[model samples]
Target: MQFSGFFSAAMMMIVLSPSLQSFPPAEAIRSSHLDSYIRLPSFQVSTSPDSQDDRFSFRKAFEFRNANECGFADHETTGVCDPTLVHVAITLDVQYLRGSIAAVHSILQHSLCPENVFFHFLVSETDMETLVRSTFPQLKFKVYYFDPEIVRNLISSSVRQALEQPLNYARNYLADLLEPCVRRVIYLDSDLVFVDNISKLWSTNLRSRTIGAPEYCHANFTKYFTNSFWSDDRFSGTFRGRKPCYFNTGVMVIDLVRWRRAGFTRRIE
Candidate 1:
């Protein structure tokens, strides 16, 4: 299960490769969706004074992970994990996007949502709306942006802090500002593209644990977590007590509400 921090930025998908259909440009797609959606320069977290508490539980959320150890052939879910209407949430820092513009456009096209699903893209304030609008305007996905100060609070402030929780940096606000109903949020990076349908990746459960994902538990798995995450008694205890089921964060389906309930975030934070 050699999934590193890079995979978070790389593997936002799980489907197999396409037959190379000539999909329209992302800009064109954005135009189609926004024509119906409220037009805006950028997206930001919306709040309402009338907001009510809508907490979550282990009953509502699930976790999934991607691992190179098993490769594509062995990556299929077992019999217990075959469900429909599964939802997934992915978080990306558009600033981390690299490679050619065409590559980024291609990755956005792979979002495996026919209808009624979420693929959350968390971009920077300085980034232009045109960057994404022109890139992936077709998918009716939600994109949000935060000012530098807010982003500072939402993501790690530095590399040193990031090493403490490589995957945690992008989700800095999960422990704080996440909506009360947000029981689980699957944190995903934007670097990789999907080969298989995302629903296939979302159908599984995490069993009784509040968190579940394929462990990057091998010796190599150590790179993604901060010394703090690796040193936590729960993680270490789980490591020694169980079969070393380390997890890669790329395709994680999390239960934020449950994690908060069990003080799981407090444990890692």
Candidate 2:
């Protein structure tokens, strides 16, 4: 499976191609019950005295009925070990909460087996969980808190302040954060909205590769490094025998089993 997206300063539109492998027909969730499954909860945020009054606000609920053209595991019986369940991981924070909600809505709207798709949300704050639950009442998801101290020292200064956030590097530790039963997962950025079934991307064959993404070999890779890095043979020689290419980390399919076995998280740090 391949996804193409055009990037610019303002907006980006991504078009994804379907997979060759076909799946069995799915039973659609009745439209009549859609309201019950997606009712947004009314709740109050517990804020400190000094916190802003508008620190947390309500979000409108969204419901998407499956077209029932594809097969899916029974939501009642499908556990984390179920092979049919499509696992997806995403990071959530105050800055991108709105975009994340829209992204989830887009995914459910386009997925053939919306019931079988489970979300693993990585978050730094605990309050976001209540907000997510209220927004998507029937969503099958779990939240994991990422400790900022783990990567505080490893993170280098970046040009953008947002890039310096600890949550930005949470994806690097998915191998450790997720359960052992989860063999693979699709990691998506909060900004993107899926126009096609993500199951196609889930069915992708990684072959011997532990990770798969759109590679950009045409870009000038040297600009990513400092002049001193190129001057030192020790740093520049890391790519000696390989043809390396830059790939966006925002959207990727990662083989967690291979990642764990290889100790990739530690190596990245």
Candidate 3:
């Protein structure tokens, strides 16, 4: 069952961002008026016109921007975890290290979940060994790795290409190596922590839809994915063609069955 050396592969990417409160009220992010604007993927730092999507901004969609005057780490500072995060896949694909996992624990420590629920992890060769030995010894989940060389081949011809995976590379590709039993999963970024229980969040409904995410109240979402492709058709259908709903990749319930049935992964590619 193991693809082993046949396919290791590579890539990094962007998805969505969340709010900024442990007990995050949607109202806080709503105030950002992000609802009024379709947040496009752009570089965190800008140096040239050609470097707009330079970093994995879109992949960081689940992270929260600090609104507090003093900057540090606060579990509740960003968006709150959904009540049903358990039903989905809580995953982290490690490219390097940024204490994102610590942040994930900050919330999960308090958020409730089924004892059997598992936290999936994907990491690079450099970090994979340490990840299991250091922080995750008995956390109740399976950790897997791929030939760094294969990942390199997917990108170029050397495993060094894997060194550049921006941020959301894991979430964007984790499902590929997942067990067949995992037909659907909710992907959450490590930057987030839950202030409450997530059992109910996983239970969120899909209703044959490919995914279930909070619909945005305003802003033409079509532009978010369109502006880059020169045509809005890429994800013009992400929200069923309705005005973009506030779809946060940090917290989304995806129907893998539909995702596979409709080739959602191919669409995202």
Comparison by lDDT, 1 against 3, better one: 3
Measured with C-alpha atoms, the lDDT of residue 106 in candidate 2 is 77
Which regions in candidate 2 have their CA more than 4 angstroms from the true location?
1-49, 56-58, 217-245
How many residue pairs clash in each candidate at the backbone level? 24, 1, 32
The lDDT values for all models are: 0.41, 0.71, 0.42
Best by TM-score: 2
Give the per-residue lDDT of model 1 (tens digit) for 1-269.
23355434344433222532354222122112222143333333212225332211111111223334422322123211222223344443322332122223333344344332334555444343445444454433445553345334444332343343333344544534444644556555433355445544454465666655554544444543567766677754645645545465544667666677777545654
Could you tell me how far off, in angstroms, the CA of residue 187 lies in candidate 1 after the best superposition? 1.9
lDDT of 3: 0.42
Q: For every candidate structure, what is the RMSD over all alpha carbons to the true structure, in angstroms?
A: 14.8, 10.1, 15.5
Candidate 2, position 207, lDDT: 88
Question: Candidate 2's C-alpha lDDT?
Answer: 0.71
Using all chains and alpha carbons, the TM-scores for the candidates as numbered come to 0.47, 0.74, 0.48
RMSD of 3: 15.5
